[model samples]
Target: MAETSRGIGGLAFDASKRARPPELNVLIALIAIVAAFELLGRLLIGDSFLFNTRDNVDGIFNQQRLEIIILQVSIVGIIAIGVTQVIISGGIDLSSGSVVGATAMISMSFAQVALVNGQPNPKGVFLEQGWVDLPVIVPVLVGLACGLVAGLINGALVAYTKIPPFIATLGMMVTARGVARWWSKGQPISFPTESFAAIGKGLMPVVIFVTLAVLFMVILRYTRYGKYCYAIGSNEQAARISGINVEHHKILVYSIAGVLAAVAALVLSSKNLTAQAGMGVMYELDAIAMAVIGGTSLSGGRGSIVGTMLGALIFGVIISGFTFLRIDAYYQEMIKGVIIVAAVVLDVYRQRVRSRG
Candidate 1:
């Protein structure tokens, strides 16, 4: 039937339209930068920058450097996945890093082992309450609970109370950090159970990050929540007019972001085998940078989890490249700032292109 044929054709066009602005741009950028670094490596030291030519490490690539880059990016990338959703929904979360710190301190309290090296845990602050050496699930649950509560509070302020997201999350950032420090009078918590430590050991962090990214990517592309998120971000008033529950949706978004931050904390504290008040310093910034660089619009309504993943890789490579070149840490920070601004500018330009097109 001609009518059926036309309908099928229309559907195909719609699908393609939705997937417009492929990740080719970001992917190309990634490849180009890696090439630049490779060229630089040859010029600077006559060594391979992206490949392993030495006997100290395994694989054709520099396995040690590769692992370091992946492990470091994986932790922050987890947080970025949640932040990507928040930004896509036309909101921002400034409290993720503090949430990570707070969640780490709180959860590790429950994860502490009864004995450390055959001795009672010297660092167990909750031993007096018999909270030591709990099952691995206990600490994980505690961390998620902390995140849920923080998210609820943030949602209440931004949704029902109509407070600005920036201010509400900012207030939470300070409050959460203070709670982290006050949890045990500024003492670091250590001596976690073997099971808890195993969660982030070796390449596990990268595995977790990649898994979560894939799951969320599917959610964003195929679910009602994803559609509503984009609708709200594209135009809140329009979404509300169409009967979407804007306030409740925002609450859910912030809450999910909180949970991801907590998850990041669990992995981070596990990797370090300690929970300190100073953990996750500036993590929120790094997560935001990852999302922004991956081509997520701060203004909202346009982004993909895949793009964020690539952005995270770019971030890791740049950091690793800088270290490879022996660039100063402080200078790296400055360059990072510039790159963030450039990404946002590019985002704006893309938006203009869409509007004009």
Candidate 2:
């Protein structure tokens, strides 16, 4: 009996000292993914995944491909950062994609230039000329307000009415999409003023995403708001009893998420120079997938902006690598689905192991 107790005590001691930061594991996975693509590129495409063997470029790396990878994912990466926070706070948001679509349409209308080549702008949404060529802030504030209202409604429903987050967000998703289509009668909104266009030019989206990520990383790690989020997510009853305003925090979290979605809309619309009702389709799913793959637990109380950023990179790398290998788009979708499920399964397994220990 004494030996048995000693053995158990030793195991516990070992387990206590074995604690590892989850981000390290995610970083390792990212490196492994990059290496895999490198190997496959050489074998299947006779080209490199990240390196440039061509003599035209002085650098050893494929700079253009690298830029494309970052640019392509930067917009969605913004949404992922918000999704990471929401998940950590034990809530789900299914309306961010729709919010992007709606905000884009509405904002673009106010951003229209008065004339195109010295003629009345053909794509103007407003019949009155006064609505055209307005200040860029007009559209920006209007767009953000749309997101804020939608988020407030979502938060109120989830926090006060006790509606399930999935149902609440799903309802907002449909409503926001309807609003998007209605905003322009299913027509695309195009042509913004020069000031508005600058918002997403070149690498601006990447800069915006990285800036937000770093800012939020600090917020989540150091602020009382961050502590409340983790606490509420880990155990709402316990947090409430401990004096954390769970309901209020929930509202704030959803509100922030909504604003982030709007930010993404602004960047996306500016980048494309147009806003279609179909814009941002399936973006919410992709954002959630990025967060999950970055090691965020869907069960809540655990996630990070940094992890989501890395996940976005992983997502971009995989897609770019597949295209470089000339893989079918259908196959690419299937593989992406597999990766999402695998990540979720791994998270569940980790949770179970932790519980058992």
Worst 10 residues of 1 by lDDT: 11-20
lDDT of each: 0.90, 0.90
Clashes (N, CA, C under 3 Å) per candidate: 0, 0
TM-score of each: 0.93, 0.95
Give the residue spans of candidate 2 off by over 4 A. 1-12, 15-18
lDDT for model 2: 0.90
Q: Compared to the true structure, candidate 2 yields what TM-score? A: 0.95
Q: Every model's Cα RMSD, please?
A: 3.4, 2.9
Q: Clash pairs of candidate 1?
A: none
Model 1 per-residue lDDT tens digits across residues 187-302: 99999999999988999999999999999999999999999889999999999999999999999999999999999999999999999998888999999989999988999898
- Which candidate tops TM-score? 2
Query: 1-357 in candidate 2: lDDT tens per residue?
Result: 646545464643354645587777888998899899999989987889889889978798999899988888999999998888889989999999999999999999999998889988888998484799889999999889988888888888999999899999999999999999998899998889998999999999999998999999999999998898888878888999998888889999999889999999999998889999998989999999999999898989988888898899989998888889899989989999999999999999998888887
